[model samples]
Target: MTLLDQPTGPSASVWPPDAHGPRRDPAPLLPDPEPFRMLGTPAADKLDPELLRDLYRRLVLGRRYNQQATTLTKQGRLAVYPASTGQEACQVAAAAVLRETDWLFPSYRDTLAVVSRGVRPVAALTLLRGNAHHGWDPKAHRTAPLCTPLATQAPHAVGLAHAARLRGDDVVALTMVGDGGTSEGDFHEALNFAGVLNAPVVFLVQNNGYAISVPLSKQSAAPTLAHKAVGYGISGRLVDGNDAAAVHSVLTEAVEHARSGRGPVLVEAVTYRLEAHTNADDATRYRTSDEVVAWRQRDPLAVLERHLREHDLIDDAGVAAAAEAAEELAAEMRAEFHSEPELDPMSLFEHVYAEPTPQLREQADLLAAELAAEADPR
Candidate 1:
């Protein structure tokens, strides 16, 4: 029996008005008691060998990309980078399950996910490099620009999904956000809209233990970030983000659920970022090295590699091939960043509006005159 079925006394009235309206059983909507895992468990043995090997290859590539991007930041080639050094499983699995027609809405830290979805690595980092508003054409790939603002992309995903539903298009929009972004109004609003509209949307919350330096405990009192779905009336899932097999399985299920018109789903992936929030932040100030060391034992790449090796799904040759491919990608990234990007000063104003406003026109003219003077020098 539910809590509504039990009353204290005659003083207890019909508490929730269940008799007056329809009610949903919240049990089916709640997340698993613990994060769903497959790696390090007997279940890992049954995963497709081919699939596991593919995931391993992508994880290796993603890790190398993270390292190379971080190196660029140190060398002053890239302006800033939010390295997904430890979250390769989440990114690769997410990309693996997405269809070409499906839309991806990613946050700043999800540049790796974008690249995995066919956006060129150099193009994906354009925003981080301060080179362009969007490095690649978002429309061509059905991926939105990597949003830097917290939780803002959630509503965009909801709107697009709802519109697709109305148009009878088979599209599922997946928006990935941090655990901290759960507190934002845009996140809540998107959840509410998705619930009411039954939009084909999935929310992937990569709970990497912190919102910047603030730990998850200090951020919210929810039993788990996945529980955030209950209040919004969508299904919730919890997954071991470090387990490539687990993340891929859970996301695949959730995306299919949404695409099938069951409404949106919320999935919280429990993981950690081995690196600081970014190159600019000091993670050590709030977190201890011991804690980091403990988490490193469950590193996504390492966990997947161990499972693959133990099952004989991948051998020395496979490992060597993956590493060599990663090195080539890293080398290409280094070559790409070697020269300065050719930026047009006036081009910034081009996309602001169809017809430039008077103020915008004035500003563009001023910038143009400045450029002319710089080119001529009297």
Candidate 2:
């Protein structure tokens, strides 16, 4: 039974709201009525010119990376790719706000963020390529595996943050999840635990409008994803996911809040997934062309570029330089992915356990024996 359903006694009268309900003070947790925008605003003038340039370059490369990765999928180099074509701002800013020493726990859609976090581009796609369990070493890069299971990474981020606090480590764990993931039990548990433990972690929800074939309208009826944070006693922030400057500014604040021992914070970046959920899904089946076109007008890269140009921070030469660099990166990825990778079937059993069980060892031996026989006979 829920707490609200419990029988109320004389002592219950002393409780706040007389046990009617949680009656949480939500004023402090309310997100802005509209998603915060900065690219075209006067506030954009105050931002550092170099930082704006950096964001623009990253956005350019990030867009190119998404295109190349999607192309790789079509070419059979990558098993599948969930492109962040229109959501480059969220990806880039998520990384830009983080320190190298900080940990990033990313969902499968966050490969761009992983790459921006200093992981080699090729290594970040290892899992997506189906060549390895994870693309990079978690301990080495301070990035967890790209989680395919929805909302599971939330709890992992909370656990790591809580542990770091216990050990007196000066670290913050920023976990990224999609809006749909907010409905999962793990998401609730993680938020609740983080709030109670005062863990230094930031939860970023990229509200990309749809969860696969499902639209946000079919999802939870929460006013905004950020509002969910208030229930957990954590701060909530909302920002225009298409505005890189706004995303970076908001995330920077949230990260600083967590790092300062103020407890966990939740940020919802309002973005739209312009592409299909993956190369395998047909977006045309669910969305209209006009809708896609509308979002394209506010494209993250274009918005930032326009802002920079208006401020005289970048000109045609700068744009060309950025594009050229992006092309080079894309070319490098294409060449690297075309090369065949060495594989060992036996290696799969190696990392599954520290000490393999007798049953596992027997299975491994059986596979090995079968391989050896086939090698000699065929």
Candidate 3:
């Protein structure tokens, strides 16, 4: 039989019966063999000097924000704070890449990203403040509330992107998740839907060494988190998470690709969390001080600052200006957290539904009556 007419497995089609089945070469979707770098490389010269300076300023501010937020938790201001201490590059670049019209769906540890997107510093921590409602208006800023559930925001982002496409709107929804979140079913579903629907969305996974106390080795065996995109027939990109310029470049490309109706892109940023997972986590138990110190040697802020100074993009005055700005923000956060918010217990029933259910209405009435009685005793 001719090569094309060969039969196998009792089938007359071809030697390989599945030869006609649809297949796609995954080479284009695979991540780079090495994490993309920019800071210490010649590529750094290609970035805009002004943009580099701005990124430096933001990184400084983000570091201060993480420090102050963690202090708030110690002072009993916030119920819990998930500090992105060492991952500022990922946070800042994730927001910097998007346009004002785009949406940012952030995880609990991504307060810096939300704040970078123009949300008030204190308001970004509202959910962690134990408030019943989100601190910032999602509709007003095109930012969703800080999601505490792992990977849940991924699906929400995909849904929003798909809906926008159906409405003939050109909007990109970028969502941030940690390495641990990639293991969730929601992550898988989101990638699947985004690929099938060709939705405009970008998934940024900050592979910051550990998912809580679990190291990356335990969370995923995939060569890299970005490689997971290939399974969904999407593009995958890997970057030095601590390199602000590289993260911004990669994410900007992914966002633009999605904006051009090319579907989704998954980017994995290799970073390290310098702090415990949260105020509640004890990282010492699972990790060694040497590991933390080694990562600190490659701190994102320092890395960017080095590049800027080397390129003469920033000077002593510029560094001082950035520090002053960060101090001002920290002061603002401290003042805001020290003051108590005026919360109405009854307002909890307001946003639960368009129309309150009978049970909810009854509870609201009961609470109102109790407050009235307490205000003026009979």
Candidate 4:
């Protein structure tokens, strides 16, 4: 049989059905691979209309927030910022399925996910503005601080899951990392430990293809990153990351699995990064324009918005209103950042340790004296 007409079954032999003679060529590896199964398929039609509308609003807000943050950084308001322009679907969908009781360990680019989960916009900005050690307390909201060091949050999530298991808390830890981060040793270590300990955690890897200019092909030789979990002896899934509904469904299943004490699962979200790595990095330097154009067609916000409109959950006017409201909120947040009190350099040592060291005390005193000396003596 021709390659196009080859039987897709376990019984089908690598030799063609009509091959009456000895095989002239070596068989190709992995001919009839199992079809990629998506989680949450059965639940698509069961989503509430109100939740769909809320998802749309959150998507728009996330897009607007990233845009404004980029503009602000360019205008000298922020030190540096990461943009989650094209990955809203993964963030929003996964966030929507989470309970407030669930724990979240997010990277810096996951501001959209945090915001969707009720993190105040201004509070998130506090980290970017160098005003707070962390955006919010993890114990208070069950969300960890934004991890700037790549892939470091994965193991932290594992620790949280271990703690929850010990305390007999029915909470799951959902940790997110980029496709590029999967190369880090921390990522592998976390996955292994979670599997061995049967930790209640979900590893969500947003595979946007390029890890700061290094393409996914260079990052791994595995056919699919989700397959990495097989070595760790855990469940793994690969999903269409651009489809918010699909993401939501898969994450809901994963969360349920963890809550039911099924151990850990790894989800590889096959998506793309639409914008540059940051406002600073130039995508044109490495990626082709054709690639950007192709991924642009799969924009998650546009896909979800279309889905909502077709379902009649929202109208054009409703979308417009959401955008307007998001703009107002962004403006208010910007104003709040501007009005924040100046950082006290002396206060930097205040929370460094449980008890202050003599050297730290002396440094603090020196800083206070310098500030006092610099004050106007009118």
Candidate 5:
């Protein structure tokens, strides 16, 4: 069977209330109308103005950086770029709630999330420049390397959470994946193990409706990805991924839940990929113009900007300053890239072993001698 053909159990029938007799009206394709799940008794009042503004800034920076990276790729400075243009809310909100002691496992598109956790901008550039396996030290920040293989990080996150529990630490591991990753065997295995072990972890699924060119409907038969947690007996929720405040609220709750030893939570943030899957893919061939237009109307940055303006937290001047600052930061980043050191050939062999083995040492010496001879030209 194909990926989409995976069994999702029985399907529920759709019928309007007050429908009498067998009326043959076609069911409209209605968007799910779940109420935005806010946290606390007085949800809106629970979050302070400062926290809200900070979230907005982080998300805005993420967007600006993504745009700059795309431009860099076009100019042939970066080898390849994966734009997370529309997924800022998911990255920022989730990263914001994570404690410094907690661990973060991110995918390649989650540079913003890593940055939020105190990883320097220059460190992130190391990976894009192909000079480092990962940008930051895992032990220092408790963050794993950005995994490019789909859903592979899920199991690693589970292992981390397990280790934390064994050590009697209160640390929780949070990892994110695209909607398409849920179909991977690693995703299910990780969830199952977390459930059985009662591990403190959060599985964040950014359901942007497509895995590359494939639509969500063609990827899975499930009505909603959140329901995947039902079999594992873990708490699950689906939130408006485009709503920054909503995303923050849900993640805060998830973090608290895991910290309190309530086991794990599966959060499905329903979002959309505004740009092509990457710089390489042509989304126009698979998705319709009308669909893309509709999603753009709900762009996360635009939605949050309107919210901030209406609430009197930010004004035109604040928006202008933020934009200007973002551009300046991007400019500094590009300059830094130009001055980055050349990759050391021997450095590759240096990190492979704690103490170099006899065979490896001999190979490194041989390579170094060849390099030295070439440079000397004697």
Candidate 6:
């Protein structure tokens, strides 16, 4: 069977299938490997109008967010930013698939996902701006701090999912990571525990060709990243990450599979990073401009916008409206970041423990006294 003919979810009896089905001759691994595509296809005609419009709006907004965040880093407002320029679909789909009670464990690069899930745009950039406190609280947002350590959030998501299941709560935890993170020991251990405990968790591996300067070819010898799931005895699914409709469809199925108490799921979203790893890294040093230009042809926003227009799901006015909304958000973020934040000197001692020790109390007193003396020095 052809790659497009392969089943898109765990419902297929084959359980796990090679992205290329079964090829008799040795086949060169295609980076995309005929990923399950929906937009620009017949399947797109079946999508709900509401869903299409929502995806369209988010796609436009996500791209704008990435662009603006990268600009902030250039202006020195943000210490650094890992833009999701070409990977908006994965971010939007992952956020759209979860329930409100669910939790999201995002790697540092997933600011788009966090913002798409109702997080305030400026608050989402706090960590990247090198702020002392994450602008948003974890419990209030149901999101974890943007994790900088590679693959560490994997085990945290599993522990939360397993504990929620044991507490009789219908909660699912979804975590995201880049292609390089798969090589980390934490990733394997988390998947192992998630499979054994049947935790209600979903892993979205955005295989965007490279893990910083390192390419996937150097990270693993596996045929496909999705294939990693079989070793842990879980279901695996693949989709064209740039195709927002396909991404939304696949992620929804995976999340439901976990939520229904079936088992954990691993979804590999084959995509590309249109920009460098971060503002600090130079992508041209490693990759050619021509390669980036080719990926630009499949930009997620354009794909979804075209589908929405063809299906009569969104009109020109709707498109303009989405762009206007995104622009407004970008402006607001710029205005907010231009102002200096009031940092309390005492916050360093807070949240470290439920109660402060005598040593800590003594230090707090000394710090307060110093502040008081400065204020009265005239």
Worst 10 residues of 2 by lDDT: 14-23
Model 4: residues with Cα > 4 Å off, grouped in runs: 1-47, 355-378
TM-score of 6: 0.85
How many Å off is the CA of 227 in candidate 6?
Answer: 0.4
Higher-ranked by TM-score: 2 or 5: 2
Candidate 3 per-residue C-alpha lDDT over 1-378 given as tens digits, one digit per residue, 9 for 90 to 100: 677666654444333537656456899999998999988888877889898999999999999999999999999999999899989999999999898889999999999999998899889998899876678888888899888999999999999989998998889999999999998999999999999899999999999988888889998889999999999999999999999999999999999999999879999999999999989998999999999999999999999898888778899999999999999999999998888898887878877789889999899999999999999998
Q: Tell me the tens digit of each residue's lDDT in model 4 across 287-355.
A: 999999999988988887877777677897999999998898789767866765767677678556899
Q: For model 1, what is the C-alpha lDDT against the true structure? A: 0.92
- Show model 6 residue runs off by greater than 4 Å: 1-33, 352-378
lDDT preference between candidates 2 and 5, better one: 2
Candidate achieving higher lDDT, 2 or 4? 2
Candidate that would win on lDDT: 1
Most TM-score-accurate candidate: 1
User: Model 4: clashing residue pairs?
Assistant: none
Question: Measured by C-alpha RMSD in angstroms, how accurate is candidate 2?
Answer: 3.4
lDDT of 2 by residue, 157-264 (tens): 999989988999989999999988997899999999999899999999999999998988899898899999998989999899999999999999999999999989
lDDT of 5 by residue, 158-267 (tens): 99999889999989999999998999999999999988898999999999989988888888887788878866767777888888888888888888888898888888
lDDT of 2: 0.91
The lDDT of model 6 is 0.87
TM-score per prediction, in order, is 0.94, 0.92, 0.91, 0.83, 0.84, 0.85
TM-score for candidate 2, please give it.
0.92
